[model samples]
Target chain A: MTDFKVKGKVWLITDNNGELINDIDTDQIFHNQFLHITEISEMGEHTFGNLEGWENFPEKCNPGDIVFAGSNFGAGSSRQQAVDCFEALGIKAIVAESYGAIYKRNAINSGFPILIFQQINNFVKDDAIKNLDEIEIDFLAGELKNISSGKIFKINPFSKVQKDIMEKGSLLTI
Target chain B: MPGKTVIEKIFTNHSKEDISPGKIVWIDLDVVTARDFGGPNVVKNFHKNYEGQSVFDQSKVFFTFDLTVPPKTIQYANNQMICRKFAKEKGVKVFDIDKGIGTHTLIENGLVPSGSIVVGTDSHMNILGAVNSFGQGMGDVDIAFGFRYGRTWFEVPETVKVKIKGNSSYDYSAKDLVIKALSILRTDKILGKAVEFYGDPIEKLDLPERITFLSMITEMGGIVGFIPFNNNTENEIKKMSGLDNIVPEIKADGDASYSEIIDLDISDIESMVSAPPYPHNGMKVSDLEKVNVDFGFVGSCTNGRIEDILKVWTILKGKKIKEGVQLSIVPATIEVYKQAFEKGILKDLLDAGAIIANPGCGGCAQGHIGMTGKGEVMVSTGNRNFPGKQGDGFNYLTSPEVVAFSVLNGFISDREF
Candidate 1:
């Protein structure tokens, strides 16, 4: 398999202080009250509707933008809508300090990308993000680079199974 | 080498491969479940992606219409029809309109026997851990794969051991015990890990209480909660699931390695309630006696069993809910509903001005019938108190006894009687 790099403009799923919020549950990602709308293509319009600071995310975000988050992102409920919303928006990847177990699997199985970098919080702390324009992730090189700051951080490589799943584009494909 | 926990053992046995925490392994699923919201999506993917391939085993795959039973709208009705059409064509087990909550329906019909490794599209599928099954929630896409090929991959979870060591003479319910446990462990501590509850107090709990305990672990961000299978659990499983001669028990070794071991004394616990906004935001009920409540709810998969209802009736019988409080009671399943009705539990609740909703997810799923209004304060027996979990209101998580008392008094109660 070839090395995969996710390079895109960064979007913060954070609080007012710019600290990445912990436990951003699925209900906040995509509210369950709108679950009756079954079509994934139409889901992007309502992404982050219930969550504060990101209610207008669909209007602000561009396709291929990468989302940065804190610990336990997508924590509650197993609504694939949480993932499908991102897929519908064409979000390139999600880089989080941690994730809910089911969301990790769902993202991978849906052929979406989510990476774990433990030190991500250090780089995106309160107001440090205003200077950041873009980020680049090279899994094979095991590094994340800030385009504006030119500061690079190391990330753990995927396990054999994860690498295989990413290569195959989905778990079912593997 | 240390002996494996029940989760590890199940994975090892099913995959026919050595498995450890953090290592991903593939295993054929014994059962797969999807509720109303995810069922239609699974059906769509199976048809559009799999080229109309048949499921691995029709009987093992099932869908239940719990979230929007009886179809509250055209969209929901259409979703149910899509799932129903798929089930009809594929010959799979499909429980529709008023079959009860999905997990309760499965348990009531003897589908989830001991020693089974199960997966469902809904997060609360972890409730099956009470039956000693290796049950975990997964995304509907993975469940779709399980439906198509009967196999899925999982990373073996690290185990957290909890041992209960005391008895309670107070009006404490299993909900209180789990809320207190969540308060101690917190959500981050147990995220993605399997929690195994054991010891004398666990052994003393009946089937309903055991299920109640397992159901609340989801609120802690845990993957699954387990009570080791013993003769008592086996007998209860036989009695409730109607499966006699259960398989031999699966237990952790005496030297089983756990990431953390929590020792809890039930007698040290008082009636606990979770404050608004989070399930782990717990405090002693006595500390919040001045808080007024506008609504009271006494049902959900978490605490809607016969035993839980009895806990409420023990206090609320021959008493009226406060004039200003609106109380709703929903039993978990049709069988539980029937049992409650036969025992006159439903009559007692209705006579006390409780509005009994249909036997489904109801208020627990949120936005269903009988929702709490914005700025309204509710004391609920449901598992979660997350914002909008039961509508635009402030929710307090507590035992049914407390919920019953709060309804009668129109405030968060401190008194046992």
Candidate 2:
């Protein structure tokens, strides 16, 4: 992909079998117990806290790190805290095969970047994508390049409204 | 114009400009609602962002205290207090802690008629689709904006048409249909898309059954699941609110364009349960034969209506559940509670050894009764069976009949057992 803009280290959300965990719901991202905490900064510490085998996501995630996940990544609950948790972590973007309806809307409205990487499974099997691998993304083209491995994968591009909403910075401004 | 789906019609009605799926458009809202769970956060955002500005319309705004009514924790108490204060200042209405679920309250109160657009804080607000209305759940930030402007931006979503075919047997209920559908369709088929259900069997579904079935679209990763308006819908509205002007404004064209189409038959559908860890993990009740149940809950937005309660009573009448199984019966709304009390349904359930709780979202939020202890297993009528949804224990979702039967047997069972 030419004119690569956003770049970051890859962080994969996989199960113990190293297979991508699909249907990673909002409850897994942010548990209901922490709903009382209103401060955005505090939400990061609890990111992925409810998820099995990923309780340490908050402690391990670094700024400018991009996350990859399986389909329906943000399933369940419209709790904005799910999206805010990633924003608090300073994550560059999340690429999943699909997303929950309201969760996708929340991320787009908050100006948090999210993309759909349809064939992430095949790439993971080929060893072309790995955790901590450097990568660059072309948002408009929906192209993701493995900078370290010299491989690229096709991704669904943002819709017109999604781009406008992200560029305008939140739904209210749009 | 080529034919248009019901969603297209609804979106076009809310928006003045020409609209299409995937197109960004600002739409007017018919109503804005928030529950205790998210109302406080909306108030906080309103003060932080739209301070000194009047809400777009006070009459259309409502605060429903159903998520954690009576304030089990100090945090929830303070949150409810904030919502009450903000609602009073804005001259809006607060349904209070005794109102049960906010969405069900709106339905019971006739606030949401067909074709109406409703925005709320509860993610399952799309449950409104059962009545042919367009309902969606958003976060506090979105609700705060909606409160200020009485409008919000939406990407018109394409529709998936699911045709429900065949008749159900005596033992099977709408909950069985929903779990069965979730198993076949899973999350991939409907994610971020609207679903239109039309077929022979669907027309026979009453409002309560429709609510039981439609409430699950969220679990299946769908934006909304709609059943076209029928005589039962009108009859329920009249019976519930004494209003007859509830006919929706639009219907899908005969030749509407659809992203995908599916047909699901229920003739062979049987009692099933969505086992622990996921809502869509459906397996036959026979498959869970020997699994002992420590607790049983027979209510929620999914199956807490009077009709469902009637089903529970029919199954448990004159028969006590297992001596050790702790059974809790929580109705969906205050109106439902009143109906049950007036009709002696609650008395029968209580006589059957059920500990009746106040009308609200029980255990679904871990807010009220039905939350399980570690190693405890609960068979619930609620839609979700998430890991920590009802408690530390495993929550298996099933029909009211099945839950009632399980409580009687002290283990998961079908009606015949």
Candidate 3:
């Protein structure tokens, strides 16, 4: 089984005004022009290619980085490239207020970690979280520790099937 | 007895253990499918894990090609060739370019049974919910797993009950009703939940109209939208399948618990239009400033059925599209195309100076013919108005009546109620 505890740098998917971005659909995360590329390794460079102010996210992100977004993180189409592109960049996890229903299924079945943070509005209000901050997450414990801000918060933990799928890395393996 | 929503009842019929929201359960799948866009990836993953193996049941699986059906580029052709080879070698069926959108093919051809589960690669597969079925879209590997095992895991979703009351006095279509729902509910009101539509207005909708309303649930973030099966639903099923009892007599109990119950009144609803950046960003048609539309399209799984085509024909019958305005019409399936041709609907549209494309999803993607240029405005009947969906142009989503009137005027306009 993989590590239940993960520590990585957090990159906030926000607007120029520093507010959390909501409804960042699949098209913005990975544009339709790159749907032809089947190989996961080649998907990293095109992450956020269609979104303004974040087109160079692939070049700026580091391995084992974590991401934070607002409601409906993957709102549009069920193209797996939206989730696969982040895996190609070695993202540890994605924390959002909520997600599109099918997008959550696609992420869970692929063994990618997408956690729910319901109180993210409070974090946004206080400006408690910043980009490139260090954070630690425990999947089973439902805990989040923001080392940069010296704060700890409770999160929604994994479901029975999600925990099982992550251990095997995908539904096919399990 | 206590109450259960349509989703709970459907899962109870297919699953082993007790069912509830947030409880993960493995359920039997009645139908499994993939299309050209993601079919090849699913095939590759299937072989990688279950090498030299046959699918769980060949009859349950199919490949439908609607996206770039004619193979616009060499890469696309190569991808389709892989699916064709795999389907042939595995003795699986293929609804090739001759067919229309895979989702429509399944419903119109009666491949999907009501009150059952179906999985596919297209996100809009939730359209099956129009017929009281539980349909969902998943990734390549997940679908691959379904192909091998014929079962998949699903967490029962909490349902929201929407009671639609008050028939509008204005002569409106399903498009107007759905637009009114979006404007009232916005995007996230029903996120991660199921919507059970209940009311007299809902029961009166025809099969095509029911599909048109439920197809937009994807934009609302609902997993699926269910309308209790009525006499019309059963009649349509019987006609399509040519069999009796295709639609099961199942429904949510009267006392079912819903996360939220909303009463949507449509008595005074007005004609609506959605502008670019998001399809739910709607405004009254009369309030929108007139914008020149160089490109126009009327076809997609959302509203490309026979009824929608008939609406366009009635409007454009002896009238020509304005000069310099290029309008394209595509039927959703071959059956629809054949019917239109036999009834002389295609001739009337052609006489109105409209270009009639084959029955497939030609105008919905960049690989198709309807992509627009920078600063150009396009008024379409497709479900989405997301950027880059039809290329660099600004996209506006509206009803066929609105589109027909807009194209005739060479600008954004709506038909009188």
Which candidate achieves the best DockQ against the true structure? 3
Candidate 3: tens digits of C-alpha lDDT, residues B1-417: 468999999999899978888788899998898887778888888888999998889999999898886888887888889889988888889999989988889877777777878999878888888877888887787889999999999888999999999866777778878887877777788888889988987877888888888888888888899887766678886775555667565688878889899998878777777788787787778888778889889988888987898998899999988899988888899988888888888888998989888888887855386678887888888888877778788999888888898899888887622
TM-score of each: 0.96, 0.96, 0.97
Compared with the true structure, what per-residue lDDT tens digits does model 3 show for residues A95-134? 9999988789889989999999987867966877778889
Ranking by TM-score: 3, 2, 1
Worst 10 residues of 3 chain B by lDDT: B240-249
lDDT of 2 by residue, B1-417 (tens): 778898888888889978788777889999998887778778988898788888899989999888776888898888899989998888999999988988998987888877889999888898888778889999888999999999998888889999888766545678888999898888888888899988866666788998888999999888888887676667776677556786644688998899999988767788889998888899988766589999999888889898888888998988898998999988899898998999977777888899988998865875478578897999999887777777788899999888888999888988645
Could you tell me how far off, in angstroms, the CA of residue B296 lies in candidate 2 after the best superposition?
0.6
Positional deviation of A45 in candidate 2, in angstroms? 1.3
lDDT against the true structure, each candidate: 0.82, 0.85, 0.85
Looking at model 3 chain A, report the run of 10 residues with the lowest lDDT sum: A121-130
Tens-place lDDT per residue, model 2, A1-174, is 123258999998988888889988888899888887778898899999888899998789899999999989888887888999999999989988888888888888777889988888768867789999999987888889999989887787777767777787777665
Question: Which of candidates 2 and 3 is the stronger one according to DockQ?
Answer: 3
Model 1: residue B288 alpha-carbon error in angstroms = 1.6
Report, to 2 decimal places, the DockQ of model 1: 0.66
**Positional deviation of A64 in candidate 3, in angstroms?**
1.6
lDDT of 1 by residue, B232-254 (tens): 76778888888776777777778
Fill in the DockQ of model 3. Answer: 0.72
